[model samples]
Target: MPNLGKLIVHERMRRGIGPEPFADACGISRQTLYRIETGECEPSLPSLRKIARVLHVSPGKLLDLGA
Candidate 1:
């Protein structure tokens, strides 16, 4: 499986988005975003949906789970 943290960080940076703004866009706290990005926590499905929406990606794409 792809590393979720790396994927998120990569996409975020690719879009020129900072952590704080990305977290706010996702309606999550910056600390939560940091934890998820650091592999310290797994985002819930709803959280994933929110993030995916903001990043213009599907949740499965964010999770990297094969169809």
Candidate 2:
């Protein structure tokens, strides 16, 4: 299993993107994004796509399932 939400936060920080603005760019509420980042909730595929798109990254980057 992938820790996708953690990966999202990690990558965002690695790229110097903050949680609040990143959440805004991803079209999610900051609280929801915080829950996801803190591993409280697993995002749906649609949510993942929105996040990935906003972050300018592939879903696999968020999933960390790439070979």
Candidate 3:
């Protein structure tokens, strides 16, 4: 399966957004964003939605689910 963490990093870099600022824009802590990006924890639905909105992507794009 494609790694969700890698995907998040890829998209974030592609958009030229740093982790701290991105997390701030998403209304989440930098540590939480780091954990999510490192695959240490799964994001809650609300968190995922916030991320997707800030990243201009669909939440499904951040999920692995064998896609």
Candidate 4:
């Protein structure tokens, strides 16, 4: 299975987005974003949906990476 953190990082970079703005867009603190991206924490479902919306992806795309 793919690491959720790495997938998040790859997709974020692929879209040319930086962490701060991305976190802001997701309504999360940069520290929370860092934790999620580093596998230190898993995002709450609502947070995951927010992240997917920001990234222009479906939540399943993110979830499937770890499935």
lDDT agreement with native, every candidate: 0.88, 0.84, 0.84, 0.88
Quote each prediction's TM-score.
0.91, 0.84, 0.86, 0.90
Which residue pairs clash within candidate 3? none
Full candidate order by lDDT, most accurate first: 1, 4, 3, 2
Clash pairs, candidate 4, are none
Q: Count the backbone clashes (under 3 Å) in each candidate.
A: 0, 0, 0, 0
Evaluate model 4: give its TM-score: 0.90
> For residues 1-67, could you state the per-residue lDDT of candidate 2 as single tens digits?
2487778877789889988889888888999998898888888899899998887888877888681
Best by TM-score: 1
Model 1 residue pairs with clashes: none
lDDT of 4 by residue, 28-49 (tens): 9999999999999999999999
C-alpha positional error of residue 11 in candidate 3 after TM-score superposition, expressed in Å: 0.5
Ten residues in a row with the worst lDDT in model 4? 1-10
Score residue 21 of candidate 4 by CA lDDT: 95
Candidate 3: tens digits of C-alpha lDDT, residues 1-57 = 247778888989999999889999989899988988898987788988888888888
Q: Write model 1 residue lDDT over 1-67, tens digit each, in one string.
A: 2488888898899999999999999999999999999889989989989988998888788788842
Better of 1 and 4 by lDDT: 1
Stronger candidate by lDDT (2 vs 4): 4
